[model samples]
Target: MAGYKFFMFDPDNGFETYKTAEEAKAAADEAIDYYRGDAGDGWPDEVAQVCWGEIKQETQQVGLRPRDEEDKSSCEMICDYQLTDI
Candidate 1:
């Protein structure tokens, strides 16, 4: 198979890049497990958002909540976190 890079995001841990998708997923899963042990409910929504690119919002919510949540959206959830041509 073709080579690919994996990226993971953590609030306290920042971001990490790995040589393959499996490595990246493992890192992310580990991060979630760590955070879940420490942060409780606040962790998953953020981690899930990172692991999954899409975010859902209702039309009725106003202003900052929607916008703030939008800012955290990531398109690279299940794929390469960053691309380096070299």
Candidate 2:
């Protein structure tokens, strides 16, 4: 399951691993749904406009992913990962 690094950049903060692009998208979807449930269809947009005066996403910029075949910048090299107990 080796692959090139996937960097997740937060506009308000530093970079971190998004695990995969799909995971990043799923996280965004969940956030939007939760906010919409609490507010309305335009929940996220409305909140952003009121708070920051614009619309923004949680996952801001996605960094460059190297070519997998070349095995450049491995995911492990980019992200801090460890196991945890339940």
Candidate 3:
């Protein structure tokens, strides 16, 4: 079976794998909600926007990225999360 990954901070919890797309989407929504909540005040609006874009892109065309194409950005200042296979 294929797996879905919800992007997160790298070097530690880079991303989370889900057995289904719905699960992955829920994870993505939870992350986005956190970023859009009070805790997000420390971050720029772009961060949330970037995260939303990542989720949107994944929903539009679900797929995993090649390991070589993975972007390991800190995802602090910008959205650099990439959905990948588990």
Best by TM-score: 1
For all predicted structures, in order, the TM-scores are: 0.44, 0.32, 0.36
Model 2 scores what on Cα lDDT?
0.41
TM-score result, candidate 3: 0.36
> Once model 3 is optimally superposed onto the true structure by TM-score, how far is the C-alpha of residue 33 displaced, in angstroms?
0.4
Question: Model 1 over residues 1-86: C-alpha lDDT tens digits?
Answer: 12334566776577666666677778778877876785654545555644511112212322333334445565333222332243
How far in Å is the alpha carbon of 49 misplaced in model 3?
Answer: 7.9
- What does candidate 2's lDDT look like per residue over 1-86, in tens digits? 12413443333333444546665555444544455685744444532421111112233334444446556654633333343321
Best by lDDT: 1
List the candidate numbers ranked by TM-score, top first: 1, 3, 2
Going through the candidates in the order shown, the clash numbers are: 0, 0, 0
TM-score-better candidate, 1 vs 2: 1
Question: Residue 68 CA error for candidate 3 (Å)?
Answer: 28
TM-score, cand. 2 vs. native? 0.32
Lowest-sum lDDT 10-residue window in model 3: 50-59
Residue 27's lDDT within candidate 2 is 48
Model 1 accuracy (lDDT, Cα): 0.53
